[model samples]
Target: MLRLHDSAQGRVVDVVPRVEGRFSMYVCGPTVDNVPHIGHGRFTLAWDVLRRWLTFGGLDVTYVSNVTDIDDKIIAAAARAGRPEVEVAAEYEAMWWEAMAGLGVLRPDHAPHATAYIGQMVAMIEVLLAAGHAYRIDDGVYFDTSSVPDYGLLAGQPLDSLRAGTRVEPNDQKRSPLDFALWKAAKPDEPRWDAPFGAGRPGWHTECVAMSLELLGENFDLHSGGQDLKFPHHENERAQAVALGKGFSRYWVHNGWVEVEGVKMSSSLNNFTSLTDLLARADQRAYRLLLLRAHYRAPIEVTPETVADAERALERLDAVARRFRLEPLDESIPVRRSDHPEIEAAGDDVRAFVAAVDDDLDTPRAVALLYDLATKANALADGGDTEAGHAAAHLLAVLAGSLGLFLRGTDATLDAASSALASARDEARRRGDFAEADRLRDELVTLGFVVEDTAAGTRIRRA
Candidate 1:
């Protein structure tokens, strides 16, 4: 059983899906008006890890992450670039996916874009208008916050309390200061869609309300996003769904922040570091490992010292793989963490690793458990406890794979000649021709490859 920190409950609770064995999850994807930043990377990796683990735990999962391809930001960027809004959206969206691929994020089961769902957005807004949950203004249609009594649920504040600090003043058309736009009427040179209310676009908040329900259905098992979205964005999205007399999400999960020099990295703050720049210079796996080495809910600081440390940790994982000639965990097939026969044979470590991650994704401890397993495997194999060492290595791989860390022996693949030489050396060792095996090993070492023999077989890695 996985216990996640449900933002709605403000406590850790077990995720019991309405339909047994199948989990429906919706994560708010990027509004790609610019290059991806470190914060974007963290949010994606956090939910990605959660999604991967759910499948790893043998649960059927339908994960839906959307793209806000048409937004105020995207429109603005397009205007600045002297291009069509769709072109700007498409360009950045491409960059977004390219960056996500570099970070090893799995593609969503369905990626519904806002532009494609304009019809659905209009229909949902009509339902709200008919239900008297929304009203139209000179600028556009606005959701009547007063209609939904419990509107600020995800924001963790009461409507009255939140409205007290509301900024929507001097707007006489709106009934209350807390009222938000459900649709924005077109301005000069901006995109527009026909709606009964007017020819305009859907507000940012309205986009997810329609997309999530239309794709995943009413009352999906989980709706997740970063902590920054818990406020007005998520709260407003929840309100629209509730106003239409539909259940939106059973659980709301929010991941923590990423910090730099002790301040939150955010575009609004103008302090975000680009994800592309970081990935270009640092090991992508190291960044993933760095995220995993911290409690998923804790703020992670990406300094040279931390990233260099994560790289060293990744080396240990690669060492185990090389020592055992371990086949890499394929990202395509996510199975139960202990499916490996060797891992199942190792008592308790698998269970302990699963427990740590299952407890609200306590990845810091989960990573520490992996290090412990790696240490045990290395020491046992060195001390001639081959069987136990194999089990520990398998356990480590299982845990790492659950978190999407596929450990490869090396990035360097051997050429045909080197492969043949390695095979000949294996044959020589089997024939008790130790002298010949040593000669081949030296040849490989001279070619910048590290070679080792285990009880299972000989392993090779690039030096």
Candidate 2:
């Protein structure tokens, strides 16, 4: 059983306890107005890990994530670029796919775009209107919060307080301050689609509600996004579903924001860092490790120093994985690490690590536990304790797999960098620079190779 906290209910619940073989999950995707930042990378990778862990545990998972192609931001971007709406959305959406693939994110099972799901969004809004939960005002349709008695229940904000504290721009066409737009009327020279409410476009909050219902039905296993989305965005999403008089989601997972140098990362504050820019300076492995260094729920502070630390940490992890000739443990073996006394001593710590991961994905704690196991495993390997060494390697691989940090033996690509280094050494030796050649030979061996200057030739192994 997985314990997941429903942000709506503010309590943890068993997500798939009684389910048979399949699980459904929905995550809020990018809006496609701008390039994604390192903060978005954190949520994307974390959810990808969660999906992998559940699948590894023997559940068939069907994941659906939506792309919000039609939004005010997209409209603004189009105007700024002097381009058509579809052109702007298409360009940015392509960039999104490229960036995510570069970071090793598995494409979602169903990536429904808002423009593609306009019919569903319209139908859902029509249902809300027919159910007397929404009203079509002069030039727009707005969800009437008064109709839903449990308004603000999802976010735990009092309705009275929300009404008082809410700020509205000059052009908001709503009957009440608490009411939110379901569809906005078209403006001159703006991107517009013909909806039931004349020529207009779908509101931001309605896309996820409709897409989730269309793909996963009324209720799904999980709904995930950033912590900042909890208030108005997700809060309004739940209200739209409950207005249909049915359950929506069982669990809501929100990852905390990434901070920079002790301040919240934001474009307005000029403290933001783009993932693409960071990737230029660091490899994908190092970029991911920086985010995984902190727990998902805690605010992560990103700095050049922090990124450098993550690079060193990832190198250490790769060094250990390289040392072990890892193979998948047999399912029939019961995966018993307790029989070995060394592993038995580490059992409590291992259990704690798994528990933290299972308990809302405490990745930082799990990472610490992994480093501890690595130290013990290295010591055992040096002492020639095969049984204990194998046990430690097995446990470390399992934990590392949960973080998407392990390199399986089957998937090891030829190290082009290493091959290039060897060629460079051969060239140096041919040029009679014996001093440089000798330094390169030592460097190659230190990098997990058995470089031999013999009559036969140089060789490499699992050093």
Candidate 3:
């Protein structure tokens, strides 16, 4: 059994142990209009860590994320790029998958594309309309927020207040300002599909509700996304699900936004940083650490210095990973309840971290716990107790697997760096520059290599 922080209740709820231990989870994935940015990466990494811990805790986890291939933004982006909508969406979606895989995120069990589920979305909207939960506007279909009594519950906004604060372009067709679109009418030269209402496309919120229900049933385990999604997006999703007479998502999980120097990273502000840009400049593992440093709910203020710090920390962790004999740990170790106290404590910390995650996806606390474990294990290794060292090492391996951090293998780039260092040393030695050789060896250590001199030969290992 594990305690999960419930975003809906704003409290921790203990999930009862089931024989099958199946846990269904979903994260609101990207609208495949453009390549993802650092903000997008931060959310993905945070959830990847959470999923790792859940798997660590011995849950039969089935994770799903959606690819929103059809949206106003996607159409606009396609037009802006002078490409077909399908071509643009596919290109960006392919990039999203490649970038995520390179960043070491485990591919979700299911990745349903919105375009593929047009029939389901249309059917779902039809159900809502028949139930008196939606209304057809002039040229489009709009969800009637007034029909749902608890319209803004998830957003913590009352009905009238929500309507007042909400911004819908001064439109006379909408029954209320808070009412969001369910289907948008097709425009000239835009992608369109035949629907009962008209030839149109799915609204942004409609796909998730339809996809989640179709994939995970009316009720599922978890729903996660960026903090910005809580209002309008998630809130609208909840109302849609409720209107469809389904339980929707059980737990609402949200990771906080990435801030730059204390301001939210926004396209409007021109403060957004693309994922490709960051990956180009730094190692992927370093980028993960930068995100893991903060609680998921706490806004992270990223700068060049902070990213550099993350890169250095990753080097240290990579050194530790390289020292280990790469092997899968014994299946005997229970991810949730282990015989050893240390193991149990580690599991507890994970539970607490995720419970905080359950609270609102408190990723920073989970990150802190990870660093604590890494520090303790490293300290134990430093003490020269090889048995404890092995155990600690094993723990780190488990944590890495569970949290999707510290991939314990040789990256080709790192290997090339080692080869270059060796070549540099060899050149220095051939020049009879003993002083230069020593300096090069020292430099290799800073680059995460371990070097030792012996009577017969010199040995090198990743530091």
Candidate 4:
């Protein structure tokens, strides 16, 4: 059985699925008001690693992540940009997907946008209000935290401790400081949805409650997001579930924060560097490698020195791939250990990788094992232990693929922008516009793409 750290249980526990022979997971997604940052990518890759591992292990998985398309942040950005809220959301959501694709993250099976589920959210709000779990105020409706006895289960604290830490709100109408909004009454020129209480929009906490239950049914297998959401955002979601007497997520998992320099990354810090900018300056795969180097729940710092180190480490892996002529492991291939007969002789390496990965996705140790296996593969081959050498190399590729690291057949990884430029330059060349083609190649070079023209076409990589 896979064991994971449960934020609600406050410990690593065996994963007992709500149903037999299946897996269900719900991860919180972006708000889509602005371009995603490295912090966003970190959370994204962390969950993507988990989803890939589950599927790689041959379990049928259903992944659901929600896009908060109509949040306060989106409304604010729309107002500032003088555009419709929906238009602002559509623009940034496009930016989000382009970034995710560049990082090779898989799309969720179901992406429930907040705007599409306003009706469901309103229905849930009605249930909460009918059961006396929520109350209306001058500005909006708020969830009464005291109604749920175990309100702080996912917060890793008792109700009193959770209440004590709440930032005092100027809205004194709230029953407790720990209480949160269920619906926000429309402000002037803000998007509004009609509800029994009034015309207002659903709160951030309510969307997941409705979408997860509707899509995954009650008592879904896992609910995960960044550690920052565990406190109020997720806690409020769980509270509503309990108040209405519904079975919620079985296990709660939250990844640690992404740090910049020595400090934690946050928009308030004015340091949410756009993921687009970071991908432009560095290899996209290097960021993925850097993420794999640390434990998912451990806070990781993103710095030039650290990223450069990760890039060098990837070069070592690529060198082995080039020497052995190894092909990239197909991600869709089954990850059964027995399928690879070569690894049967390399049992120790296989066992070591599985042992580390089984323990809360201990990727740091698992990645170290791959490095050690690659070294052994090269040395054994040079020493005439051909059978053992090839086995080690085969196991190394499989293990990295299991962790969603595709090491073979890669030049420098390219961002969406550079890749598009490479395509456009090819079209320019085909039209016999040599000047424009040269200009495009120069642009790619300035963005760190190694532009090469061949008899086939221009090849570009942004490592």
Query: Considering every candidate listed, which one attains the maximal TM-score?
Result: 1
Model 2, residue 340: displacement in angstroms?
19
lDDT of 1 at 437: 95
**Candidate 4 residue-wise lDDT, 276-376, digit = tens:** 98888877788889999999999988888888999889878876675565766765443554456666676777778878887898999999998998899
Candidate 1: tens digits of C-alpha lDDT, residues 1-463: 7999999999999989978989999999999899999889999999989999998887888999989988898888998999998888889889999999999888899998988899999999999999999998899999998888888888788888987887666588888878889899999788999889999999999889888998889889999998988998899999898888898899999888999899888898888888898888777888899999887778889877787888888988988876765777776666565466656656687788888988999888999989898899999988999877877787788779888888877556678888888899999999999999999999999999888776656667676
lDDT of 1 at 384: 91
**CA lDDT scores, all candidates in order:** 0.87, 0.76, 0.75, 0.86
| Number of the top-ranking candidate, with lDDT as the measure | 1
Model 4 poorest 10 in a row by lDDT: 331-340
| Alpha-carbon RMSD, each predicted model | 3.8, 5.6, 4.7, 7.7
* Candidate 4 global lDDT: 0.86
Local lDDT at 106 for model 4: 84
Q: What lDDT, from 0 to 1, does candidate 1 have?
A: 0.87
Better of 1 and 2 by TM-score: 1
Which model, 2 or 4, shows the larger TM-score? 4
In model 2, the runs with Cα more than 4 Å from the true position are 170-173, 267-270, 325-352, 408-463
Give a tens-digit lDDT track for model 3, residues 1-463: 4555566777667654223577888899998877788888988888887776677666778889999998888888888989898999999999998889767777888999999999998998898889888899876899999988887777787899876776667588778888888998887787899998999888899898888888888678889898889888999999998887888787887777889888899655778888888888887777777777676677888777899998887766655555554455443222442323465545655566556544434555665665676676668767877556656566665554455665444444557667777777877777889899899898888888777553323446664
TM-scores for all candidates? 0.90, 0.84, 0.84, 0.87
